[model samples]
Target: MAAKRILLLAGDFVEDYEIMVPFQMLTMVGHTVHAVSPGKAAGDQIATAIHDFEGHQTYTEKRGHNFTLNAAYADVKEADYDALLIPGGRAPEQLGTDASVLDLVRAFAAAGKPIAAVCHGPQLLAAAGVIAGRKISAYPACRAEVILAGADYATLPMDGAVTDGPFVTGPAWPAHPAWIAQFLTLLGTRIEP
Candidate 1:
């Protein structure tokens, strides 16, 4: 099968495991992973550690995954990627509000490509006007937002992911693997490792 390019939108205070799990899982399955920040440089952003709540983990240091800013908020276009993966935490709150980011998101979903959002990541979908009438599951705090965006919100086992057409969402970090699994499956790729 052809390789798939997954775009990861990250920022300071992103959930550590939420981003890394999907990145590692997809890459191990032979997909190309590109991590980019709201800024226009290939650098590290601080992420909250799953095991160490007292410390912040740098993306490059923690995962050995150096980021390449292939497209910034001002430069991103949906036509450039095969799929989109948005991780949770405070990152999405900030990233979702950017006009350019929202435009890119709308383009991706409007074009019918796979789009996955975990935890607070769904907030971006709501903000981008892409979650209306779709079924999704995000962090508990996002229930109102998702519903207000016209999505059907449900509380699942919190360990599995849910896919709605080109849109996929999960509850939280524990569901990271499930989220990536659904995404890879939709992309016609196997989910191993």
Candidate 2:
């Protein structure tokens, strides 16, 4: 399988598992994955948050590891990557409003690239106005935003994922197994045992 160059969007306080796991897994599978944050340079580290569901009305957040960027956001060009990844976390809440970030997301959508998002990552999609008319799954709290963006909100199990055309989405990190698998399929990545 040809290794695809993937661009991963990240920011301060991004979900720990959401960003870390996908970056590692995608790279492990022979894909060239570049994790980047706006106005950040390569080697700069961003803080991460660990979100857990422990019988609370909302998930609890804790400080997580620092994730370093392998690429510079200033150097990003939509055509450089074959796919886009947006991991859930508080970061999306902040990144969603960044005009540059939104524009990049829109470029990926216009190009019909394979895009994968988990949890609040869909927030970026909504803000970019790309998920409209598409079926998308995101963290429960983001359901309203999904609908507001004109996308059909997919009610999926925490471990479930859904794919609509060039997009693949999941509720949270727990759905990584399904989310990443579907994305791999979309990227034409064949994992032969």
Candidate 3:
């Protein structure tokens, strides 16, 4: 298959795992992943908001990841990509609503491309007016917003992500594996082991 180009969106305080895992996952399967953030520089890796089972807060190294100017949101032509993946965290709530992000989301959906959104990531879809009548799962805090946007919400295994038609969603960070698998399978690419 030709290179599968996928867009990964991020912003301030994004869950570190949510952003990294999917990027790693899709790349492992020979997909070209672009990490796009609203910041001028590649955004800093942030600490996870939730505590560990032992009650310790976890943090990540501040290594800079890829920034969006490389594929500036304003230039996200839908035909260039096979799909779009939005990893959830505070990022989507923060970045998803940005006019550029919203515009790309609408453009991707309108072009009939597949979209995978996790946690608060769906808010981008809602803001882009693309979630109406779709069944999705997201962080509990986003349930009301999803429904308000005309979607049916469901709770899924913290380890499992769900795919509905062209849209794929997962409840939280731990669901990255399922999120990645669903997208790759939908994209029909095999990971190069």
Best by TM-score: 2
Better of 1 and 2 by TM-score: 2
Clashing pairs in model 2?
A: none
lDDT of 2: 0.97
Q: Write the per-residue lDDT of candidate 2 for residues 76-153, one digit (tens) a residue.
A: 999999999999999998998799999999999999999999999999999999999999999999999999999999
How accurate locally is residue 107 in candidate 2, as Cα lDDT from 0 to 100? 97
lDDT of each: 0.77, 0.97, 0.72
Model 3 clash pairs?
A: none
Worst 10 residues of 1 by lDDT: 58-67
lDDT for each residue of candidate 3 in 48-93, tens digit (9 for 90 to 100): 3331224334322343343222345444566788888887666677
lDDT of 1: 0.77
Compose the digit string of candidate 1's lDDT tens values, residues 154-193.
Answer: 6876687899899889988778767877887889885346
Clashes of each: 1, 0, 0
